[model samples]
Target: MSTDVAIIGLGIHPFGRTPDRTGLQQCAIAVSDALKEANVAWNAVDFAFGGSTDAGNADTLVSELGLTGIPFMNVANGCATGGSALAAACNTIRSGAGKLGLVCGFDKHARGAFKVNPKEWGLGNWYGEEGFALTTQFFAMKIQRYMHDYGITEVALARVAEKAFRNGALNPNAWRKTPISIDEILTSQMVNDPLRKYMFCSPSEGAVALLVCPASDAEKYTKTPIFVASCLMRTRRFGTLEVFSPSKAIEDQKTVTQDASKVAYEEAGIGPGDIDVAQIQDTESGAEIMHMAENGLCEDGEQEHMLARGETDLNGRLPINTDGGCIANGEPIGASGLRQVHELCLQLRGTAGNRQVKASPKTGYAQVYGAPGVSGVTILNS
Candidate 1:
């Protein structure tokens, strides 16, 4: 369903390593850009919410931000951090507790996949020792099973990566800007069985921020405001089957992405058919394929067909991951979701140069899912 909140400004720090700057520093840069775009001063913000993984607490930003004294919440919900923060910020406005709010995400991670501990995730320590906890391992197994069940090919995986990098080439801020041929991608070293090194996104660093205000007051901030149609976050419930998951859902059941996407669509009063563009989680090529179906953009096994038909191309009927997604942008966990939103806002504003969707997209969708079964979805309309 429609909401009164509209995003008045957007800003981002390029998604990649900046050894000279700390994660929080990057966040500060994004915040300044966003505030400047919205023409809103820091002290004028009624409230703020932000999140990060490796960065310092988001609330600690006040020391450098002039201590506006507004409530600045710190969120840590793994990769879904941005989604949660944005939802909270929207609710703050919808609840009449605040008229203007800011939400941001940023992080800096070491090379390679995250070192996740089962116990740290609330599971037994044995789950980690037995090798049932690594993100790459679980992703590989899940995708392998999905490929078999749906007749997806190894070529499809390479195509996904190829598309991601191709789009990244157009995105100046993307980390992997050079496009690679499918042959080169397919020949890349295999990281986990069918998942090639090129197919997976590295754990990297970046930051993103957005300014939101009541739709009635959007003109006071910016000339082009993307209305917040809906924003919701959900977590996997009982009987959800994620193979490596320590929970009892291994037998298989509804996923958090499915549930969240459905509710988000209902709230936004739109469906997949209305989305001119989309940006779903693509930690790897396989995740993109699975999320396409899980988010109801397509039916089971239809991603292969969708890709084959060029439906996801920049000039096609629906362009997805126009900013290159996680594969080309790298996953800075906290900032990834907001990065998707930022790209969508650009498209809706008709400012996505070089990589812009030729169709003049009016509506967009995004989904971000991560560890502990948390998932978040948002719909935007211009």
Candidate 2:
């Protein structure tokens, strides 16, 4: 693990609809909670970085969070916003330019917020009009191809959703609190072929904040400080199949998440086998199944047996998405990736409440994939 930076505090705003409060209001609350957890006043934060997809500007948070005059930059990377923010803060501290910093993300999306505009990417207006631009359709096609090629079955997709909701029921901050059966998920409305309505995450609202400080001062913040092993972000390669890509190159290459994960493992001085728990990008059920392999947690086609044997459960060999992930927690865009890190922190500290892994996990991994082919991976150890 890295000896340069440590996560000293964490704060979260419950995911889902909150008609009464604005998105900025929620962000202020998360920051306040993080400062309290770190036992520091707002002015002590030497730098700040955060943002959202649809919520107001992040720099405006200074008004409510105190006019500390610290350099607060706004991150607007698609679904990788939170992860990108964390990387920036960590690098800032590692550079010895700051003693302490804050990374926060929050978003408030409408019921159907992830709509795509093909023309914006130069894919042509027909792309959207012909339904080739819907994200759900792309996920369905990718998983369907994998099933045909690797023997993954439709039932495996349902199993992923089943596990997500089961874990979500145990998470107090999760949006969907009730468990959903596999059969219910199997028969749910078919949003896209092979992908059901229950298998996808909704566009919702949430906020997450994390406090980073020099590892040397970790003991003063909390007894259970979680050190940052490595945090890396990468963009799509020419031949990779990324979101919103009209076509792939003639030669196939590893996905952005796959590349980022492998490099992160090397940087952290550990391999996939050392990871005891993970929170992967589950924008849809199939994304989790694919991400499991993409992140090197499992081999291709092994997911079929793993899910069938209940090896991915909270008490299983490797607990994935202990907080229900995007599938159950809903995608808050800016906050989603940070939500993964927040969950990893709690899991590593043994404070995840009812959703805690049965075995005390020493190392945790988190990955997030976003639009236009950006991926971020983080490794943490207790």
Best by lDDT: 2
**Model 2 Cα lDDT, one tens digit per residue, 78-178:** 89999999999999999998888899999999897377888766689888877788777778888888888889988999999999999999999999988
Candidate 2 lDDT (Cα, 0 to 1): 0.91
Using all chains and alpha carbons, the TM-scores for the candidates as numbered come to 0.98, 0.98
User: What would the per-residue lDDT of candidate 1 be over residues 1-382, giving only the tens digit for each residue?
Assistant: 6769999989899998899999999999999999999988899888999999987888887887778689999988888999999999999999999988889999999997788867778788898777777888778987998999999988989889999999999999899999999999999999998999999999999999999999999999888999999998998888875535765634677788999999999999988889899999998999999999999888989889788877888987789899999999999999999999999999999999999999888999999988877999999999
Once model 1 is optimally superposed onto the true structure by TM-score, how far is the C-alpha of residue 264 displaced, in angstroms?
0.4
